[model samples]
Target: MAAELMRETWSGEVSVVTIGAAKSEGGTRSAMVKIGGQKTLPFLFAEGAIPHKPVIALEIWDIAPLDWPEESTKPYGQSIKDPLAWAQMCVKEFKAQLLCVRLQGAHPDFGNKSAQQEAEFIKALLKKVDVPLIIKGCGDDEKDNQVLAVCAEAAKGERCLIGSAVQDNYKTLVAAVLADGHNIIAESPIDINIAKQLNILISDMGLPLERIVIDPTIGALGYGLEYAYSIMERARLAALSGDKTVASPFICFIGQEAWRAKEAKVGSADQGIMWEVVTACALIQAGGDILVMRHPKAVEKVNKYIEELFIPR
Candidate 1:
């Protein structure tokens, strides 16, 4: 006798969120990126539908990175000196579907760029690149609150994904994104409960759950990758099993985490790129919707891998 295949059914779906607005949508972006709207686990086409393929975003900074080692810096050459040039290089050369711009210069220890400066910088970046953007603030809580607010207003109606409202310091950024008609990134410190709670906190501020993306604070290949993967997998399971509070797409910072691994540093240039590529693939398997990465080679390879996994479903 022949046996029948058994599959688990999901009761809830991941909410769909659209990034960037085009000329038709009252914004300048020439294209938009849509993530989420999954009814099953990652790539289980036989079980359910995966409406969107995971997108890889190249990471650029408002200021040229001072600490990146030679292996990573050699790719962009002098374009890294200017954020506009760097972004254009990523879009035109690498074909990045999205860009993650870090306002690192706004940190007090960095350059201490004023709120207005950051705002203008964002406005200029929007003009230079036509792809959707994910605007991240410098990791200073008080400073981020001030800087992201102004930057959010500067890009109002563009529908960028402005982020990173944490448990203790989320009110300002939440209000900023809500007021500007953009989405917010809810960040938690690698804790599932904290991740869920932060999403609730952000949504309670009058922003709908669909407009929030969860950043579950990921780690690199050798550094707590399993732990972070477990957290993400658990969250995905909960979302599939009818949990709406945590049913949001995930955005993982692959470049920032992968390059920091000692193994990536203690090896050849190819090893470093492979480290990033492997980390990115693993996360996508575990259910990552938006991956913010560096290294053009790594991005090139991962784009191929995504094509392989996404079987036109």
Candidate 2:
């Protein structure tokens, strides 16, 4: 007799959130990307469903990223100076499915560029690329509100995901994203309770649960990565147990955190590459639905891993 197979069942599933709007949906993009809607863990195809493939979003900055380590910036060549070119290269050359435009220039500590300048830059970038975008702020609450509000209007109806809204500074960004018809990323430190609470706060503002993606702040390998992994695992389990407050899709800033680690910053090529790849792989297994990565090679490896995991046996 054949051996019996055992499987676990889940009552709740991750919420499905669509990021871009096509022409038929009143937006100019050629396509759209849908994430989440999984009935099982990362890849347990035999047990449940994996409705959408997790996506890789290449991160690009509005201004030249002089602080970026040479290992990370070496791939982009001259496109670093031009946001449009860099975005195009990511989609065309690197075959990135999505692009994340980080508005670092607007930060007071950075260039301190005006919100209007940032808005125009977004408009120009939207015209240059047809792929969906994730508009990130410069980590400054006050400036993010100003810059993102204008960007929300500039990219109106594009259906971009705008955020990094934390428990304390989410009001202004949340209000603007709601008004502009864009999705929001509810960012929280690597704590399950805080993660759930932030989601509650955002939803209480009248934003539908389907329009939010929870970002439990990522911590790279050897740098509290295990803590992040456990938090995500627990959060996923909570969501699976039918907790609506924690059921939204998860997004990890993998590249940002991974590169911040000393091993990835100054180590040899082998160590740097492996560090990023390992960090990203762990996060994927831990239940990351969207990964914002920096290195093209690391992205390639993670994409390959995702493909293999999603393949039915």
> Backbone collision count in every prediction?
0, 0
Q: What is the C-alpha lDDT of each candidate?
A: 0.92, 0.90
Error of 2 at 86 (Å): 0.9
**Candidate 1: stretches off by over 4 Å:** none
lDDT score, residue 74, model 1? 77
Candidate 1 structure quality by residue, lDDT tens digits, 1-313 = 8999889899988999999999898899988899999999999899888999999999999999997767887789999998999999999988988999999999999999999999999999998999999999999999999999999999999999988989999999999999999998999999999999998888888999999999998898888888889999999999999999999999999999988888878767688899899999999998999999999999999999999997564
Identify the candidate with maximal lDDT: 1
Candidate 2 residue runs with Cα over 4 Å from true position: 1-3
Candidate 1 TM-score to native: 0.98
